[model samples]
Target: MEQYVGLDVSLKETEICVVDGSGAVLARSRVPTEPERLAVVLGELAPAASVVVLETGGQSSWLHQELTLRAVPAVIVDARRAKAALSCLMNKTDANDAEGLAQLARTGWYREVAAKRPETRIIRSLLLARQQLAKGRRDIENQIRALLRGFGLAVGAVAKQRFETRVRGLLEEIPLLQDAIEPLLAVRRTLLEQSDGLEERIRDVAATSPVCTRLMSVPGVGPITALAFVTAIDDPARFKRSGSVGAYLGLTPRTHQSGETAWSGR
Candidate 1:
């Protein structure tokens, strides 16, 4: 009397259905997508459920991690593959998708995607935040450039820190234009300061990391870039070939060859 569960999860609600071995519907309902609430619902279902199926999405990793700790069999199938399986059917809905996923699980016709390790995920978040700060700083610089261009003034290739000092002198010569740029420069100063702070924090993290220290020993790599690369990789052993390191950075050229046609260097 083994049962199987399928969950179609969204931000606000989750549609769930349980089916027995004979494809008989046991229970079906919607539940809140919060981890604790979903866990409670799962506990209420038959304990003998063989497998629970969920399509890949943002919350799937969290749900999978929680279920693993509880010793529940949860399978996160690839969304594209699940959709292809469902596309063959005439009608589609949340319930139908859930049922299809459950049946697919039972039939052993699903592909599992890898979930990020906790440490890797944390480092990735830091890298993303650093990228945002960098982009903001660049936007502020572009604003300064655009303002200078409007006045037909070219402060050619000055250092980032010195550019402001030189620009201020030019601003005094054109009081009208200076009025427009003064506020932007004030905001730019704040943004530049924030970017410098973020960079220092990132470097501090790298300074303490043994992995980053080892990575920085390589030629043509600096501490910050080395740390970024090492932290992103997390586990070097996961890659079968040493060459994959360069490939991951997109330094290697892609290639496709046939009997008569060849394509490479992309």
Candidate 2:
């Protein structure tokens, strides 16, 4: 009998449930959340051609990739959709959710998602890290402004390059204020350097990537936009139809004929 396996994954444990084509429960077990452990359980449960289903979550992508490495076919479903489907269960529990997922698998009612490649994820992580540094530097600058305001000093209209100089000029007479804010300025400088370095790395990556390079061909699409779009989509083949890309990116129609919905703009 063809079996369908559902895994309700958590950080510490994975609750697995198996069901046959007749929608009868076959087996349920708890295993460590590691991919190796889950693969072992799957091998034992799925004797014939079967499907393993899981919802998108923090670890889902990693699990999917690792399971594929172990020769296990894993399907990732949208968490939001899965939640809506599982919500109708009379009594919800790990086991019940697993069973529900198994049923979805057996019926092939759920949509399967392409897991993001590690390279794409790595690019995104770099972008995020750079953004974090930018935010931190901005916050420190704002804190310095607020502190200066307390002493009736205004750093109005200062350019980015002149910010540190302007702050120092204001603090020349106030040694105590300089002492207090110098450490923050040092930290901000470090963050700025790191952010710049990350940006340079991103530009290099974008330059080398054929997809990003092609994306940048469009007017106004620079390295950042091209790289971001490429990373966001992960793979162009992810969507069966190119028309679905706009919808996936939340680009609703600007002008509906009845109202004002149009989808012309990129």
Candidate 3:
């Protein structure tokens, strides 16, 4: 008889449950969260397993790739949907969750999530890092502006290069202000350098990628935006129609309709 397996994955370990076609629990066990270890355990416990279900999470992509390499039929399910289905049960322990996931797989009632390729993840990480550094730089600039304003000084409409010079010129005679603002200025300068480096790296990656180049052909779409879209989508074929792309990006409005009444909101 074919068996279905569910894996409730945590940071350190995974709770595994195996069930027969009729949803009867055949085995329960725990193994380290590493995919190799889980694959070995599953091979022994459910060699005839038809499907293995796991929820999408921080480690899901890596685990999915590893399991596929080991010839395991692993499926990554939408975590939100899986959580809703599992909520029907009273108990919510990891073991119980694993059992519920196994039942989900046995019944084929879970949404499968697409795992992006490693290349896409790398590009996405670059974009995210750049965004963080840029935000940090802006925050520091704003703080400096606010601090200067407290002393009745306004850093009015200056370029980034002149920002430090203008602030220093304003506080040159004020020793206490100079001491207080120097460290913040140093941090802001470092952030600026790092942000520039990340931007160069992103542009280089976008320039080299054929997909990113094509995406950039769209009017007003630059390297960063193109790279972000390409990495986020990962696979264009995943969308059945082009019109669904707006909804996927959360650009479409939400609609509510009941009987004859209808409403839409952003």
Candidate 4:
């Protein structure tokens, strides 16, 4: 008989439940959240049926990748959908949630979301880091500009390459304000340097990736946009229709209707 498995995962521990065909509970256990421990539990309890269901969560992507590597079939369910289904239980508990997930697997009632590739995740993280550094640098520059404004020093239309020079020239005689702003400028320099490093890495990624190279050939599409599009798409062939991408990305018009309320084209 095919066994279905459910795992209610938490930060430190996971509640697991196994059910055989016809929805009979077979075994239940709680184990450390580490993939190795979970894999061992599933191997012993389900053996031939290591396929388990869990809800999407902060750690779901990482856990899915690790479990798949260990030869365990891990299925991620939409958290909202899983919540809606599990909330109907009379008593709410982690163990009950696990059982509910097993039942979901047994009946094939849950929708599966595509797992993100590790490469995509890594590149996306780098992009986010680069964006954060850029924002930080911009904020520092704005703060410096604000300080200069207090002294009636209008840093008017200064190019990026000349921003530091202009600010220093403006404060040449005003050592007090210059001293106050020097630290911020130093921080900005550090942020700018790191941002540039990340940008170079992203450019290298774009240059190495065939898809990113093609994406960059289009006007207005640069390394960041190309990388984001490639990572978001994951697998282009997964979409049956080319136009479906717009809908998938939520760029296309969508309609929502409730009792006496209708909306379209968000």
Candidate 5:
């Protein structure tokens, strides 16, 4: 009797359910969320299980990759789709969700999501860090400007390089204001240094990547933009047609149609 497996994964534990080809519950158990432990439990309970389904989440990508490495046929399903199907049940519990997922696996009625490679995730993280640092620097600068304005001191329209000098000049005679704003100026300086370092590293990575280099060749496409585009796409092969790229990036409008009426909107 062939079997199918479903895993309702949480941070620390996973609820597992096994079912036969006819969708009859064969066994159910709780195991640690670690890939090795889950693999061991599955081997003991459903050694012949042909498909194991899990939902997409923070840990799903790592678990799916690790399980595949252990020779388990792991499938990552879209959580939204799985939730829609599972909502039909009266009782919402991990065990019941596991059973529903097992049945979904048996009937092949779920959408499988592709897990991104670790390298791509790393690049994405760098981009996010750089963005946060830039935002933080801007926020600090804006706060300094606002605070200085409260005392009728306007450090207006100054270049970034001269911002600290301008602030000091405006607050030179006000000892209390100087004391209040010096710490913030120091923080802004550190943010500037860190942001510059991150940008340098990002440019280096983009320069070395053949894909990013090609993307940067387009007019107005800089290193940062090229790297972001490359990381966002991850795999070019996923798109069958180049024209569909605009839709994938959400640049195209959404369309709505009925029996006779049709409309498009952002």
Candidate 6:
């Protein structure tokens, strides 16, 4: 018997419900959300089911990847649309949500979302780590500027290398504060080194990938930004229009409209 499964997943557990082609609930249960548990449960009941519908949450990608590898046909549904479908239901529970998802799947009413590719995830993590290091380096530079300002000493407009050298000399002259600020200078140095290494890796990634290089050609796109954009967007063809890309990046303006009059820029 062919079955359709709907999974309402949270961090700790998932509520699952299986429905037949006739839309009759077959089996409903709660299972641990871990990949192993999910694989086992989905394998045991209705192996290679008709279709499995699951909402897109933080862990949806992980579950989707595991289920796909196990030969389970799963589609990650958009959570907002799923919620709107259940708006009529006054009483909402995980089980109820799971049941609703099953019905939605059976009717083919929900939007299907794509999961991230493995290589994209790896590149995204690396780029994000580099961004964190850059922020930390900025914080250290600001602290040093504030410290110098306290003594009415202004570090002149010099190149980064010369600026650091002058600050080191000034710190050495004031032995009392040298120990405190020297550690910060060391941290700044380490951050600079890490940032440089990350930049080299990002450039290499962009050079090797045709998609990344093409995205870099766009206006306002650099190697770091291009890498982030390429890694996050696994399938550019999915977007029917180029304008959708701006909306995805939150660059599009919001608007409210009525029957005749439309308001702009919300």
- 1 or 3, greater by TM-score: 3
Top-TM-score structure, candidate number: 3
Which regions of candidate 4 fall more than 4 Å away from where they truly are? 20-26, 48-50, 86-97, 142-180, 258-261
Candidate 1: stretches off by over 4 Å:
1-6, 17-27, 49-58, 75-110, 236-265
Off by over 4 Å in 5: 89-93, 149-160
- Give a tens-digit lDDT track for model 5, residues 118-170: 89889888999999998998899999989988888888898889999988888
Model 6 spans > 4 angstroms off: 1-3, 10-13, 19-26, 46-48, 83-109, 143-175, 217-220, 259-261
> Candidate 5 — what's its lDDT?
0.91
What C-alpha root-mean-square deviation, in Å, does candidate 2 show against the real structure?
3.8
- Per-residue accuracy of model 3 over 175-224 as CA lDDT, tens digit each: 68877789999999999999899999999999999988998889999999
> Model 1: which ten-residue window has the lowest total lDDT?
112-121
What digit string (tens of lDDT, one per residue) describes model 4 on residues 156-248? 898877889999998885778977899998998899888889999999989999989998999999999999999989988878899989987
Q: What global local distance difference test value does model 6 have?
A: 0.84
| Better-scoring candidate (lDDT), 1 or 3 | 3
Clashing residue pairs in candidate 5 (N, C-alpha, C atoms within 3 angstroms): none
Alpha-carbon local distance difference test for all models: 0.79, 0.88, 0.92, 0.90, 0.91, 0.84
| All candidates in order of TM-score, best leading | 3, 2, 5, 4, 6, 1
Q: Candidate 2, residues 1-266: lDDT per residue as tens digits?
A: 88998899999999998998899999999999999988887888885638899999988889999998999879999888888889989998998998899888898888787899988888988888988998999999999999999999989998888999999999986779977899999998999889989999999999999888898899999888888888888877768899999888888755435456555434
- State in Å the error of residue 266, model 6: 3.2
